[model samples]
Every structure is written in C-alpha cells, then in structure tokens.
Target chain A: MYIESQHNDRVREWARLKTRRGRQKSGLFLVEGERLVTELLASHVHLEALLYNAALDEPPDAVWNHPKSVDRRFVLSPQAFALIADTETPQGLIAVAAIPKVDPHYPSRVLVLDAVQDPGNVGTLIRSAEAFGFDEIVFGTGTVDPYSPKVVRASMGGLFRVRVIAADPARYLAAWRRRHAQGTIVATAADAAERCDRAALGEQLALVIGNEARGVSDALRALADRTVAIPMAGKAESLNAAMAGTILLYEAYRQAANGAT
Target chain B: MYIESQHNDRVREWARLKTRRGRQKSGLFLVEGERLVTELLASHVHLEALLYNAALDEPPDAVWNHPKSVDRRFVLSPQAFALIADTETPQGLIAVAAIPKVDPHYPSRVLVLDAVQDPGNVGTLIRSAEAFGFDEIVFGTGTVDPYSPKVVRASMGGLFRVRVIAADPARYLAAWRRRHAQGTIVATAADAAERCDRAALGEQLALVIGNEARGVSDALRALADRTVAIPMAGKAESLNAAMAGTILLYEAYRQAANGAT
Candidate 1:
C-alpha cells in the first residue's frame, strides 16, 4: 500500500525510528538506502516495513524481488518519503527492523565500548570489528544508542551480523571476568600504557574502547587485565578514538589470525 | 583594534577563509577553537592574524602575550567574532595561517591518496599516518583539500605536523618512481591481492590509499609494485577507506618499528 500523507500513522512511526528515545520505546529502527535494505532482506533480522518512494519508475528489483521476506511494503509519495528521510539525497527506499533482544553470550573476542558518544565512531568501530572477526560488542554505560540511524548506516549492515550487548560496564565486565578468567582484557592509554607489541595479547581477548575526549575511565581501567598503547612516532598527541580502537582490534585479529604469540 | 562592524573589510576577509576558493586565493585557512588555535600557535606554520572577541575585556594571554611572534592581532567585537565563527559554540578566537609552498622531496615512507574523498576520513588518515611516522602525505588527484577546515579539525592538528603535498596522482607517482627507484610502491584491494602478512613490506615504501567507494584508481594500481589485502575473517566485505588506510599504515609502521621484515 502507498503512504501519501506525512501524518499517516505508518509515516509518523517510521519518522520516530530516527530518534534514540523513539527507537527505545518502539524497539525498532529505520535502515535506509538500497544497499542496507538489500542487506536487511538477506539477514534474519525481523522487519516491520519495507518502504519505497513511488515517484521512481520502480524501486530496485533486488528489494521488490524479495517481497516474500518483507512483513509489509509501503510505497510512499515523494512528500511522505521526504518527511521521513534522514539524508538530503535519499536513495528512495528504507526498512524498519525490530531491535533484537539482549543476549549475553561467551565472547571469543570482544569489543567493549565505554561512553563512546559519537554515533559515527561507534558505527565505524562496528564495521571494523566485524571485518576483524570480533564475536561480541558490549556497549557499556554512556554509549550512544547503536540503533541511531547514523550508526546503523555507518555499520553498513555489520550491526545485524554482530551480537551487540548493552550493559552497565563495571558490573557486566566484572561478571565477564569471572566467566573468562583466563582471557586478557585490554584497554589503551597514551603515556602510561605499554606499547601493544610488548603487551601479552592472547587468543581470547576483550578490547575496551573509551570516550572520544577522555581515555578509558579509571573504574574501567581497574577492571582491565592489561593496558596497552599504539606507539606514536610522530608529533600528533594521539590517534582518533575510532582509529585507535580499529588498530587495536586489527592487532588482536593479526595475532589470532597469524598464530603470533 | 576592536572591529565592531560585520560589514567591515577585515570581517569579510576572515569570513572568506571558510571557502575553498578564498583559501586558495589568499593562500591561508582558519584554525578555530582554543585547542586548535593553540595548536596553530605552537606549530611553525606562519600565522597572518589572531582575532578574539573584545567583549572578553582581553584575549587569552597565551595568544595575546605572544605579540612579537604574531603578525597581527585584531580584537573583534562580539558581533564581529560571531560573523567569523564557524562553530555554534565559538571559543572567541581564530588564527589565519599561511599555506606552505609545495616542496618535492623523496619521502622514505609516503601516503598517496587517489580520490579517497570523505573529509573526516581524509583527516583521520592524516592523523594515523602521522602517528605511524609516515614521512609525507601526498594528496593525489581527486583527494579532498587537506587544508579544508573540517579535515583540519578532524585531523586534530596533524595537518600542521605532516608535510602535505598536492599533485596529480599519475604524474607525481611517475616522477616519484624515477627519484626513489628502490622504494616499494604498495596499494591495497579486497580481492586478488596478496595478504598483507604474506607481502614483503620495506622501510622505504609508498602506500597508495584509494577512494571510499572504489579501490585505487587504474593509474595508481598500475604504479603499485604490488597490491596487498588485509585478510578478513569475518562476514563484512571490507573496511571504510580510512580504516583500511590506517590498518595498512599500521602494518607499515609495525614492520618498520619492530624490525620485522
């Protein structure tokens, strides 16, 4: 069915998914553009609605072709789509996916976030973490809503693939420590921390990423088995949070993949 | 000199630094906020002017006290400062710095950008590249202006530290080949590329970073002595351009620093 009015219940609901609070209340989030919608179709994630701008001659065939998978398909008028669109140049399609319930599983290699407020950094980290074969991503207190559209978009469908667990950091990690007593819990700092090469990174590890402005919190740092630093050879103060996190993740991946002790 | 009018010629000139054309014509760009302005002051980059809101009774002494080193200081009225401020929360200070003249030198380790176009990514790569001790950053054809404010801001002042060279990709690499005949030329790709671990990286090398959407350009690819891929064990197809560039850069730095051939 086509949605022509911005005030229509479906359009309004989709618009609400754009926000963090609305995403929490509804337990849903919007995924836009052809690539993400296609990813949405392929993934087992529950979908509420598949939307397309009817102004186009036809929506991309990859999406329309998978009509059997979509729960509901809404063809929106240009005006209605415009009202719900996040970007200035909308790709003419979007999907509403149900947020998965939290599942705290044993993590083989974990990417732990502590108050990482920037949605873009969070998404980029997710994408990198996924590429590096990380199993679980735990969002500790002070982290942004991962379901926010910018994070979802930046994740490039990696969010669906990885198991994202949001929990109170100190408590969750404290319990995690009990479960995986042998696993190394790693955090990075600039001056005081040892170079990552010198750190004893094992096969089973958890990387604790911190806030953009501040490094890891003292509370979180106390929980870490070891703290390491990516050695800087140049004059810049430090790497960006995302870059530092990704590098550490890459280092962990490298050690695991190459059988480097 | 408290400039009170927004329409003042000096105010208009400062405003013009926000644009690419104005920056190019004037051979200058803006450094905003207290941190960045402080960074600008610390760097050897020549400063044309320092402006602060006269409403403060006086500018911060760090800038104001360095009167002999600074070419000019204009204490702007709050209205004039508002007109010149790029950010909503203005720090009430800005610095206009002279863009350095292009100097051609054979870099031991080079970062060559071939159309890698997000301003943030470009800036992040600069930060990482510098942190990893790449000798020079060459913005090949299609790369965003390194001096752009967003890039400068995202670079976290690494822009000031790195020797930035903008040149045509094909011509620059070709000429570079003649000068540094012994240096290894490297580029990265997802498919049909040697795994980075397997590749023989060297101390003197040129790492070619590519467009966000596309891999390295044909010209750059042709120039590369070898193309290596960061092996991915996870489901995500590839990493973002900055992440990819950074990982490769980290690998280069790793090989160089660790004395691992």
Candidate 2:
C-alpha cells in the first residue's frame, strides 16, 4: 500500500532509524540507497521491511524480488521518502533491519577500535580489515556506531561479511592474553623505534586502532603486549587513523602469506 | 577594525571564497579552524587577510599572532563570521590566502590522482603521499580541486609541504616515459597476476590512482608500464580508494628503502 501522510506512525519510525538513539530504541537501523539495499537482499540478514518510493525510483521495484517472509513492504510518496532517506540524493529505496544479531565469536586476527569518532574512518577501517583477512571487528566504548548510515555506506558491503560487536576492549583482551600467551597485541605509535615490519607479528593477533587526535589512550596502551611504528620517510607527523590501521593489517597479511616476519 | 555588517564589501568577498569559481576569480580561498589556521600562518603562504569572530571563538585572538604584512585583518561580528565560514561549527578564525604558486617539480616518487572525487579521500591521499616521501601530487583532469576547504582540512597540513599541480595525466606521464625508460609506472588492479609487493618497484616511480567507482580509466591504464594487484587473502572483492592507494605507496616506500625489488 502507498503511504502519503507524513504523520503515519510507520513512516515516522523509519525516519527515526536515521539517528543513533532511534535505531537503539527500536532495535532497528536503516540501510539506504540502491547499492546497500541490494547488498542487504543478497546477505542472510533479517529484513524488518523494505521502504521505497515506487513512483520515483527504478530500483528495488526493478531488481528486488520481495521475499514472502518479510512481512512489511511499503511504497512511500516522494514527500515521505524525502523525510525518511539519509542521503542527499535518495535512490528511492531503504532496507530496515534489526541490528544484526549473530553469535559473537573472537577470531584469531581481529581489529579493535578504541574511541574512533569519525563514521567515514570507522567504515573504511571495517572495509580494510575485511580485505586483509580480519574476521571480526571490535567497536569498543566511544567508537561511532557501525550501523549508522554514513558508516554503512562507506563500508561498501564489506561489513556484511565481517562480524561486528561492541564490548570493553581492554577486558576482552585480558581474556585472550591469558589463552594465547604467544599472541601479539600490537599498537601503532608515532615515535616507537621498532618499525611495524621489523616486529614479528605472529599467527595469533589482535591489533588496536586508536582515535584521530588522541593516540591510543594511556590505560589502553598499557594493555598492549608490544608497539610498532610505520616508518615515515618524510616530514608528515603521522598517517591518519584509517591509513595506519590498514598498513598494519596489510603487514600482518603479508607476513602470514609468506613465511617471512 | 571591527566589522559588524555582512554587507561590507570585504566581508562579502571573504564569503564568496567558499566557492571554486569565486576563489578562481579572487585567486584566494578560505582555511578555517584553529589547527588549520595555525598551520597556514606557520607556512610561508601569502596571506591576503585574517578574519575572525571577535565575540564567540577563542582562536583568532588566543592563538594567532598578527603577521605585520598581511594587508587585511578584520575583527568581524559573530553574524558576519557566520556568513563567511564554511564548516558546520565555525571556528572563530579564517585565513584568506592566495592559491599557492610554487613550481611543482617531478620527484623521483610521484602520486598521480586520476579523477578521485571525494574531498576527504583526496586529502587523506595527500597526507599519505607526504608521509611516504612522495614529493609531488598531480591532480589530473576530473579530480576535485586540491585547494577547497574540506580537502585542506583533511590534509592536516601535508599539502603545505608537498608540491601540487593540475595537468592532463596522460600527457604528463608520456613526458616521463621518454625520460625514465626503466622506471616503473605502477597501476593497481584487483585481478592482476603480479601482487603489489612482488612487483619490482625501483627508485623512480609514478603510480596512477583511479576514481572510486570506476577503476583507472581505459586510456590512463594504457599508459601504465606494469599492473600490480594488492593481494587479498579473504572474500572482500576490493579495498576503498584511500586504503588501496596508501598500501601501494607504503609498498613503494618499503622497496625503495630496503634495496629490494
């Protein structure tokens, strides 16, 4: 059925999914645009609904075969779409889903984010982690919500394959530290003497990525088993958070692929 | 002198610098925020003026030392400052400066950007370019202007150190092909047989980074002497533009430093 009224309760709830508090309160979040909605359909995710402006856009109507089990599918008026869509140029489709619920299993190689505030950075890191074989991403306290629209878009369907969870990173590491005494918990520093490649990153690893302005927090840095630095050949003070984390992931991937440290 | 009206010709002109054509007309652009403004003053950039909100923000008075030769300095009212600023939260200060005119020399190491459009991605690549010892960044046809406010902020002062220029990439690269017959002209592809690190990168290098959606254009890819793929050990089809380009830069740096091919 087509919904025309902006005052409709169903439309209001979809609009609320654009914000963090709304997503948390409703236990739902939105994945907007044709690309992301297409990814949602392809993944084994629980779809609460598929919202679209059938009169305005070609996709979802053109590409998607509505699954019989998905109980709610609504065609919205252009006005209602304008109210609910997050992107400036809405592609006339949105996928509403419960925050992805999966059994949280710790992979040997994981990327731990500590208070990363930028949504773009958070999403890019997730994409990089997946490309380099990180199986899980731990979003610790103060990190941006991975399910937010900007991050979800920036991830470019990468997060669909990687499991995401929120937990106290330091406490989580403490448990892993006891189990894998030979494992490495590496952190990047601007001035540390050992180059990232010089340090022997081993088969079992958990790398901690810090915030933009502040490096890894003092207490969190203290938890690290060792530290490594990306060698700067020029005068740049440091690489951005995303670049630094990605370089380390690449290094770990390189070492594991070849029998070299 | 304190200016209260947005109607003032000088205040109006500063507001116009927010747009690309306006900046082209005036040969100037705006840099906002305390951190960036501080970097501007410390660099040897030609300053046309300093405009600040005398009432609301602490930066213009607290951090800035009025350089004696800057021809125009105005203490603007909050309303006028609001009109002139581009950022969502206007930092109390803005610096208007001439578009940098330093002659861009071809370093042995160069990063050629081909239509990579996102301002944040452009800036982050510039930072990585600088960090990895790339001496020049060439903004080829269809790429975003390097001097825009968002790119400037995201660059975090790295663009200040590196030489930036705009040219048709194919023509510029053709000139290099004559000079360095043995030098590696690297382009990244996801399916290429040679992995990035396995490629014999040398002291002289030019790498072409393509647009986000479409990989390097057909014509530009033809100019490349060698193609190297970043080895992905997992299911991710590709990495984002910034991450992909930065990894190539890191690999180039490592090879050059280690006397390895």
Candidate 3:
C-alpha cells in the first residue's frame, strides 16, 4: 500500500498517536526505530499497522517478513513518513501496537510509581523494575503515561514484557494488604531511617518510588509497612528518583536471591 | 553593569561557553537557573561573572549579594540574555564559573568514565559517584566533556564538589596499582561472572564504568584487576551505563561502610 499524501486520513491518525490524548482515545501507541519495532513484533500484543518510508532503505528482512499479521502495512512517501515520525533522524520503520493490558491478578513483586514526572525516570524505573523481577507496575495518580513515546523508548523493550496498569495506588495497596498479610509494602524516602540494605524486603514486595521533588505522597507513605532510605556516605542530600528506585530494587533482588540460597 | 547588545565581545564570549570548544578555551562554564547559580555562589570555584535578565525579576538577595566576589556583574537586555541563556524558560540568573581545577593528589575512591558519550549519563555518574563517596572522576579518552552544559546541569551541583581530571585510564590504573598494590581496579561488563554484590570490592578502589553501546575498552579491561557484573534476575540484557555504574558504586559504598563498622 502506498501513502503518498501527508494529509491522508491514516497518516494523520498515526501522527496523533504521538500525543497522550490520541494514544488514549485509540488505545494504541507507536513503536519507532528498528530495535523497538522488532521488539514490538516479537511481543504478543496486537499490531494494528506497520509503516515504512519508501524514501529510506528497506527495513531488515525479519521486520518486513514477520509472520504475525498486521491489520495494515503502508509504504509512505518521505513527506507522509515525516508526519508520523517522532525522532529527529527517522529510522523509517514504525509500528502501531495496542497498549498492552493485563488481567487483574496479584504478583509476587510489584513497582508503584507515585507521580514520577520525568519521562526518563519513569522509563528507567520500568526497565529496572523488569530487570529486577517486578512482575507488575501500578501507576498512581500524577505518574507520566507509561505509553508516552519517551517512556516507551527509555524502557528499552522492557515495557513489552511487564504488566502495566493505571489505577489508584491506594486501592492496589489495600487489596494487596488484604491478600498477602505477610508481604511488605516498601516506600522510599530521602529522610527515612531504616537503611534499605538492612530492611526486610520480603519475598513478596510492593516497592513505591515517588516524584523527584515532593517525594512519596503522604497517603502512600502512611500505607507503607516501612519506609527505607539508601544510605549515602557523602554530602548529597538524595539521589534522583530513578537511581534510588533501581538501587532499592537491586537490593531487594539480592536479598531474595541470597535468602533463597 | 549593563550590557545592551548581544554583539558585545563579552556577551559573545559567554555565549560561546555553550559549546565544548568554547568551554575548553575559556576554561569556564555557565550555571543557569536559581538553584544552580546559588550553589555556584556557595562553592569555592571562582565565579568569573554573573548575568541577570533585566526584563525578569531581581535575583534573590543571596545571589545579588553573594559574599564570594565575582569579576563582573551584568544586567543584560532580554535579547542579550537570550544569547547567553541555555534553557527555554530562562530563570533570569546565570553564573560563569571557572572549570574547577584540583591539585594532583591521590584519592581513596575514583570513578573512571571510559567513552561514556551520553551527556545525561556522564552527569548522572558524576552525581552518583559523589553521593557514593567516589572522591575523583577521571575522564578516559573518548568520554564526553564533564563541563558540557547538559552534563553540568544533570550533575546537580555534584560537579562542584568532586575532583575531576582528564587522563588515559591505563596511566591512572598503573599509578594507582603502584601506590596501592591491594587496591582493586574493577571494571564493569555485562558478561562478567562475579556479581557486583559478591565482588571483593576493596576499601581503596577505582571503579571504571564504560560507554552505553560498548562495554569497557579492551585496554582498560585488561588493566582492571577484575571485572564484575550487576546480576539481573529478570530477562533484560543490561542496565543503562549510568544506572549500572550507580548500582555498583552503591555496592562498593555498602561494603566499605559495613567493613568500617
């Protein structure tokens, strides 16, 4: 299929996916560049469309010939492709995939983002959470959209593997407490007294990381079983939200692995 | 006191500080925003000049009357300020500070950046290195300039506190080995067998974190006493360079602090 005009209905629609409102309305987000598109094809999510720039080199064989069927495939003129591209230097490969949804179920470990505002921080948290074995991610009020282009790119393909849901963290925390009485709900704060390395981050954990400025919300902090801080020997008042969360996740993973052995 | 034209020689010179070459030749970098300028005033680094947007509100008294004398203070026309301002929304405050120079002295802990090209990553590593008690930062051959605007911004004032130098890693590693025979020159790699947590990270250590695309340089890795990896429980290939370096630094700090007790 050829999309010759930038004003084509399909082209304009794909371009809208760059914004949060467009993504939410369509229940789809774009995966750009060869690496991300390849990851999208490998994932089980429904692929709505695939677009390649006719002006640029052809995509790799694996991408062009992926067995999974897409609803539509288009070879777009350079002008049309420019409207749909998010990056400065377009890689000429793009995919429209349904934002993943997972069934409601308790997980052994979860990551809770309480208004992590930076796209890079949110994306890094998702990537680190997945790497350290957090089975699910719950977005609290004010958190950046996990499907935002920058967040998705920063996730480094980890977004495809993890279960992400938007909901009130309070509701999830309450439900989690009811189900797993033995589990720990750990909230991180710069001022917290219990050192993270010494804290009892149990087998089942809900790690809550907060915004860069205000820190964990009062409501969330009150719900947490314990608040832990990463001990800093130097004079820095605190680490950025993503770095703090990643270090805590690693500590939790390390403790669990060591304990199991 | 008043600079009305962007074409002024001083304004042009300060504007050049936005680029790497300009910063290198001037041996100065701009610190923008209220918080950073305030930090710059408090730091021991020489404040060459201070510029304020005449159209914007007056700078806080702390900045306007900073005890550390500056070479010159300018009230710039909004157009003139735009020439020197880096951010989209200029805070009306910026300081030109000398790129800090530290006397050559051996430090207990060091962070070596080997070709880490990302400005944000380099800045973040500087922040984490300072927070985790890494005393000196050595820039390897291919590393990004620490004084780059993006890097200086991301460093969150840690750049002001830490001693940073540019030199070949092989020379530093060899000299460190000669002086402290037991010191561990640990390099990070994705494929290394020893987990970061389990590594015998000694008290005196030089931690080498490499580029995002490539791991540590083969030459640097050869000089390393040992290479350790951050063990991941989930399927993601590896953490980004800054995140990986921060985690390893935390581990090393944890060990030293615990051992000291």
Candidate 4:
C-alpha cells in the first residue's frame, strides 16, 4: 500500500523509534540503505516492515520466505523517503526490524568500552573489533547508545555481527576475570605499566577502552591485569580512543595468527 | 586590538581562511581551541595571528616567545568567538598559521591515503600515524582537504607535529619505487595476496589506504610489493580506512620496536 498520508499512525510510530525510549519499548529499530537491508535479510534479524521507493522492483525470491518478514511493504514517494532517511541523500530503501537477540555468554576476544561518549568513536571501535576477529563487545556506564543512528552508521554493519552487551565495566571485568582466571585483561592508558608491544596479550583476553576526556576509571584500572600504552615518539599527547583500541585489537589478532601457524 | 567592527577587513580576511581557496591563496589556515593553539605554539609552524575572547587573561610569556611566534593578536567578544569557532563549544582561542614546509622524501613506514574523503578519518589517521611512529603521511588525489576545520579538530593537533604532503599515488609510487629500491609498498585490499599479520612491514614501507566506497585504485594496487588484508571472522564486508591503516601502522611499530631493543 502507498503511504499517502503524513498523519498515518504507522508512520508516526516508525518516526518515534528515532528516540531511545521508543526503540526500547517497541523492540524495533530502523535500518536504511540497500546494502544494510540486504545484509539484514541474509542474517537472523526479523523484519517488522520494509519501506522503499515504488520505482524499484520487488525484492528477490530468497528474501520473500522468512516467516516473520513484513509482506505489506509500503511504497514511499521520493520526498517521503528523503524525510525518513538520516543521511542527506536517501538510498531509497529502509526497514523496521526486530532487534536481534545477542548471546551474552559468547566466549572469545571481547572489547569493553568504558564511558566512551562519542558515538562515532564507539561505532568505529566496534567495526575495528569485528574486523580484527573479536567476537563480543560490552559497553559500560556513560557510553553512548550503540543503537543510535550515528553509531549504527559508523559501525558499517558491525552491529549485526558482533554480540554487544551493555553493563557496568567494573562488575563485568571483575566477574569475567574471576571466572576466566587465565584470561588477560589489558586496558589502554596514557601513563601505563608497560607499552602494548611489551604487554603479553594472551589468547583469551579482554581489552578495556576508556572515555574520551578522561582515561579509564581508577576502579577499572585496578581491575586490569596490566595497563598498556601505545608508544609515542612525536609530540602528540595521545591517540584517539578508537584508534588506540583498534591498534591493540589488531595486535592481539596478529599474535594469535602467528601463534596458530 | 579589539575587533569591535564586524565589517573590519582583517576580521573578514581571517574568516575567509576557513575556506580551501582562501587558505591556499593566502597560505594561511585556522586552528581552533586552546589545546591546538598551544600545540601550534610549541611546533615549528609560524602563526600569522592569534584571536581570543577579550575576557581571558593574556597568554603566558612562553607562548609569545616561541621560535616561530604569533605575529598578530586580537580580542573578540564571546559572540564573535562563537561565530569564528568550528566547534559548538569554543575553547576561547583560534589562530591563523602558515603551513610549514615538509620534505617529501621516501619515508620509513609512511601512510598513503587514497581518497579517504572523511575529514575526521583523515585527521584520525594522521594522529595514529604519529602515535605509532610513522614519520610521514601522503594524501593521494581525490582526498578531502586536510586543513578543513573538521579534519583539524579531529586530528587533535597532530597536523602540527606530522609531515603531511599531497601527491598522485600513481606518479608518486612509480617515482618512490625507483628512488628507494629497498623500500616495500604495501597496499591494503579486501581480497589480496597476504593478510596484514604475515606481511613484513618493519622495513622501509609505504602503507596505502583507500577511499570509503572503493578499495585502492588499480594503478596503486599494481604498484604494491604486496597486497594485504586485515583478517575478518565476522560478517562485516570491510573495515573503515582509518582503522585499517591504524592497525597496519601499529603492527609496523610493534615490529620496529621489537627489532630496536
């Protein structure tokens, strides 16, 4: 059916999901662009509704069989698509999907973000973690909402792949360290115990990245096995949190790859 | 002098430097925030002018006596400061400075950015390169203006510390290979000959990073001594160019540090 009326209840409901509270209450979020929609269909995510420009042809046969997928797709005018898209240029496709349930207990290299408030930085870190073979990501207090549109876009579809769990950093670290006694907990700091190159990041490890303005909290710092810093030769005060975390994650990936072969 | 008149020629001239054409023609660019102004004062850059809110106390004696110092000073009202500042929260200082000359010689562990147009990514890559000990950064054709306000802010003053040069990758790489026979050119690609983990990046290396949409150009790809991919276990199709470049730069730093001690 054509979404002809601006006052339609369904349209208003979808628009409201732009807010955090609305998204949480409905267990639904919006995804835009053809690439993201294609990936979502390929993955385990359940689609509540699919909206697209009427000019485009029907979706391929492979995407039509999912039981929970929306069948009453709306044909949006170009102006309507533009209004709904977050970007300056709308890519002509958008969908409302059920938030995929993430397994909280997944065992692998995990990244713990502590109060990193910048949405772009958090999203880029998640993308980097996924690129470097990390299986899980956890967000501590004061961090930006990972499902926010800015973070979601910055992650480049990594949100769909990595298991993201939000909780308290200190409690999560203490519990995880106690359970996996042998696993290393390396946290990035400006003034640290050892440079990352010298620190022994083991096969089972958790990397803790901290806030943009402040480094890691004192309590979380104490919980870490060791604090690792990226060595600086030039006068740069420090690297961005996402860049620092990405470097460390890739280092772990390098070490593990070398050890395996 | 107090900048009371909005129509003042000097005020209008300083404002024009925010544009690429104005910056290029006048050979002057704007740096905002207290931290970056302090960095520029400490670096080799020559400041053309320093502007700040009239309410703040005079800068320290050391800031004025730097080898390459602030040539002119102006005091503006808080409203004017906000108008001139790139960020929402102005830190009460901005400076117009001359671009320092940097040698374009073959560098050890150089970063080659191929049309990575995001200003923040460009700045972040430059900052990471400095943190990881890459000596020089070269921007390929089609890249965004490095001196843009967003790039300058995101770099966190790394622009003052690092050696930045612009060139066409095809021409630069061809000449670089001939000039330095021992150096290795490593281009990052999604599907390539070797994973970045296994590549020997410690020696004199030029790491080529590509644009957001397209991977490295064919001309540049053909010039690479080896093409390397960051291994991905998750479903993400690619990594952000800055993140990928940062990981590779840090890997080189790790190897170089290991070899040094």
- C-alpha-based local distance difference test score of model 1: 0.83
State which candidate has the highest lDDT: 3
Q: In every candidate, how many clashes are there?
A: 0, 0, 0, 0
Instruction: lDDT for model 3, please.
Output: 0.87
Off by over 4 Å in 4: A2-8, A52-69, A75-93, A170-181, B3-8, B52-71, B75-92, B105-107, B168-181
Q: For model 2, what is the alpha-carbon lDDT of residue A249? A: 92
Tens digit per residue, CA lDDT, model 3, A86-170: 9989899888889876754768788999998999898888889888988689988999998888988988788887889788999
Candidate number achieving the greatest DockQ relative to the actual structure: 3
Chain A TM per candidate, in order of listing: 0.95, 0.94, 0.96, 0.89
After superposition, the stretches of candidate 3 with alpha carbons farther than 4 Å from their true spots are A69-71, A235-238, B69-71
Pairs in clash, predicted candidate 4: none
User: What digit string (tens of lDDT, one per residue) describes model 2 on residues A1-261?
Assistant: 679988899999989988899988998988887777777777777788887786674554543565732557778888888888988888888888878876547668888999999987888888889889997898989999988989998888777778888889898788767777888898777766788877888888989988888878787789887878887787636487888888889988988887775
| Pairs in clash, predicted candidate 1 | none
Q: Is the docking of candidate 4 incorrect, acceptable, medium or high quality?
A: medium
- lDDT per residue, candidate 1, A71-173, as tens digits? 4888999999988889889999888889988688857578899999998889889988888888689998899888888988888898988888999878878
Tell how far residue B151 is off in model 1, in angstroms: 1.9
Tens digits of lDDT, candidate 2, B147-258:
8988998898777778888889998887776777777788877767888877887889999998888878889888898888888876535477888888989989988777
- Minimal lDDT window, size 10, model 3 chain A: A64-73
lDDT of each: 0.83, 0.82, 0.87, 0.77
Tens-place lDDT per residue, model 4, A1-261, is: 788655677777777777788788888888887777776777676778887765557654444444545574777766565656677776667778887666467365789999999988888888888877886888899998877778877776778877878888887777777668789888888788587766668888889998987988888888888898877665436577777777778777777876741
Candidate 2 chain A — worst ten consecutive residues by lDDT sum?
Answer: A60-69
lDDT of 3 by residue, B1-261 (tens): 999998999999999999999998989999998888877777778899989899976777788777664447889999999999998888899899999777535576888889999999888888898889886899989999988878878988888888888888889778877778778899999889988888879998989998888889999999898999888877636488889999999999988877841
